[model samples]
Target: MSGIDNLPPLREVIATHDLAAKKSLGQNFLLDLNLTAKIARLAGDLSQSDVLEIGPGPGGLTRGLLAEGARRVLAIEKDPRCVPALAEIADAYPGQLQIINGDALDVNPLEHLTSPIKIAANLPYNVGTELLVRWLTPPAWPPFWESLTLMFQREVAQRIVAQPGGKAYGRLALLAQWRTDPRIVMELPPEAFSPPPKVSSAVVHLSALPAPRYPANPATLNRVVAAAFNQRRKMLRSALKSLDPAIEDHLHAAGIKPTERAEQVHLEAFCALARSLDS
Candidate 1:
């Protein structure tokens, strides 16, 4: 039995392993091999890329990646119950699959990959956002992964690709848009999962750019964006008061209108503002 044909259908695998979705772990296993395969394909040409997956409950998505002919797949699973099932995939693929049993947040994926990595997973809801932020802000230039294709609550996916003035636009949009091109590749309704979540889900694909769209210190930009969006309803003249008592000076320097609300300012303006604050 190989990674593709050896394992029972995901349903039987889940049943055999007694792997039910756990709310605390944000577990929502996608048993539809077709859907999982579709998600994997959205990563685009994985044959030469090392794929990193988080929360591979019962190895459903792991099987999909391996079958798709990824050069290698490194899956991190927190639930001990699913480890054996994932191990089964590892055993089937021999040198193709690596299973790490731990919270994904604590393990740095960069340590495991060489280069030209692509991350694909049906992420656990609770830790998804935190993991994205970590991937977004690595210690230096040229982050480990070339692209990220992961699942998120539909609303969160919208936020990642949202425009400046939309309700969903906030720190996430700014952070993601600043350094990468993020888009919603597909949508999955709640019923797609075994224990369906209350909210619908969507898959987001983010490909890293050669460099940030605007040149500003990431640390400064993060601080400025976080503070500005903290009270998005307020005008920049008011919301950015802490950045500088003379908000108009910063605004004028950044070429942004002082009357604009946090959500009204474009990413370029945010980077400009951060640069102004730096000086």
Candidate 2:
């Protein structure tokens, strides 16, 4: 679409500036401008919102977000080598773009912008899950961002959206489902990157709920899920022994079978177990 910004194609921007993907930084540059724009579109309404992007290796998706009319973009990049290249994009876009050179985990994005923020990123593989966990569990009641549109290895994406009774379903799925409606919006093969990753990648769109659907302590739920799924082969009674001696009684009170495996238990059941632990 003509609404697309005038930033040069990602490949030209990379070659002109000599930006190569650095493995140690967990960088894999997405060089397709069209694909980047598509990702921006799938992130939902951004006209009234500021966008926060983590690990924009060469500004491909960063440019796309600006083109799609994000009110403002606060992009955090860990790699200093690509700072000048992103600076060029900032020059082209004027006041709409702000680049911060720092680790995303350390930066408080909410401090930089007020509410109505959407975090969209082709997050580095190494830190993607950790970042999502932080956003999903921020201390505030309603989170700062309106939504999260993030890229991850397809396997990780599956785990995020996985249903109960599946191999991919576990702690990640429980935490995500506890707060948001998450789904897979797009898939990218290995060839989409400068140095293609061994695995395929997928974009996940997660819209936060007003609050968690089930009421339970986050700490107990995390511990229960971790232990239950860790020894998935064992029955819930045996698996939950590390938690409390009467976990089996709690399971029965929650209407869950004491013989059930973690994968067979649903989110509500997990919440029940967590609540039971508190009793």
Candidate 3:
């Protein structure tokens, strides 16, 4: 038992479906069953959780989620070509696997999914960061999903978990780290993907915090972080000049320096700056 319902091998499934990964779609199929299972495990016990999988190309990760006993798997794939391929898994798993053929950006999972859903996906490179942001900043706290287990290009993954004063630290880091504890759980070589990408990839698992690390209006923090990192080399006072004329006062109130660049500011300081603006 390859831990599934004796379905055809993923390679054969690709050949039968002629699922040639399209560059326009940012497709890179993870045909490795072992790795897929590992990703499922990293998401913790999915036995009682409904799993939301984005861009499940050929249902590689989808199968693993099901095999690991996810109560149900809602596999969202924009590419119509992969829908039928996913249907086969749906049949094998009975009612556990649900395939939705549409753009992930357009679908609001909150409106449909019940509480305690865990998201696990090998997201498309083009839209992964944007989707993660959308999930992280839903006007409401504790946005639906219990956790997120995702794969991204190694460099992109680093940015998501990067620390202050690092080259990769920027808006993504602040946004992700603010409300969740994120870290890279596994790394994948370029060769691990079908139609391997130029850069290596890694898996990031983020668990939501009951509340944000610090208190700041979400909109204000977003604007502040964007301005500060928009011209990362410039000092915060200068980079944020376009947003507010009294930027120095806000920085001083936050106990941050006018000469500090974006990367030098930590999450707490950014929250302070944002709060100061509203004060």
Candidate 4:
């Protein structure tokens, strides 16, 4: 039995259900209950917040969240094979768990979640970044979730919390840093999973700020950042030339150098550039 609950251990659950990891769906199950609980703790004070988890294979992390005292958990799993295992978890936790068998991208979690929400997941590799970008770029400030504790490939984690002038600094770094306080809180080796991934993994914790760190139109910033990094190696002047005829002037007005590459510009400068372009 998993110590966290009276339910069968994840390995047994997997065996009974024949839930082998599927590569096409980006499954890499974490069978270690202790490790999953540790990851859950990183979310901080789940007692009052509802948690939305993505890709909870065999309910390892789902169990962790519930055992860690999350008020409620809404887990979205794409693979139907794992639902019965998750159903077992629901029976153990009673009213605290809800399972949805569907794609996370297509599901509107807000429908199931209540206020003061936190999102924690051992996300599937293929769709992790896309989900994160959607969460980071919601139409309004102070998004649905109060915080996000998510696992990503270590390289992607670096990009999320990356600073200016680094290889990892790009649109993701800007988008995440602009309106939230994001940090890499934990790292795990490939062997942590059942069918280990080739690369290492890290967990990122992002707390939403009451407002953006700097004021810029979201659409404009996204457009400019996308343009700047789409040709990251090019100078801002050249990379952003398609943005406006006076792109260099806008860069100068934003206190950025025309010669600076996208990686060389910080979040504040990017916001400023977006504002300048919007003017």
lDDT tens readout by residue for model 1, 224-262: 898889988888888888878877898999999888998
TM-score of each: 0.96, 0.97, 0.97, 0.98
Q: Please, what are the lDDT tens digits per residue for candidate 2 over residues 111-135? A: 7885688999999999999999998
Off by over 4 Å in 4: none
Best by TM-score: 4
Point to the candidate with the largest lDDT. Answer: 4
**CA RMSD, predictions in order:** 1.6, 1.5, 1.2, 0.8
Once fitted onto the true fold, the runs of candidate 1 whose alpha carbons sit more than 4 angstroms away are: 1-4
User: Which wins on lDDT, candidate 2 or candidate 3?
Assistant: 3
The global C-alpha lDDT for each of the candidates, from Candidate 1 onward, is 0.89, 0.90, 0.91, 0.95
Q: Tell me the number of clashing residue pairs for each predicted model.
A: 0, 0, 0, 0
Span of 10 residues, lowest total lDDT, candidate 2: 1-10
**Candidate 3 TM-score, true structure as reference:** 0.97
Quote the lDDT for 158 in model 1.
96
Candidate 1 has a TM-score of 0.96
**Which residue runs of candidate 3 sit more than 4 Å off their true CA positions?**
1-3
lDDT of 4 by residue, 140-247 (tens): 888998999999999999999999879999889898999999999999999999899999999999999999999999999999999999999999999999999999
Error of 2 at 107 (Å): 1.1
Candidate 2 Cα misplacement greater than 4 A, ranges: 1-3
* lDDT at 54, model 3: 94
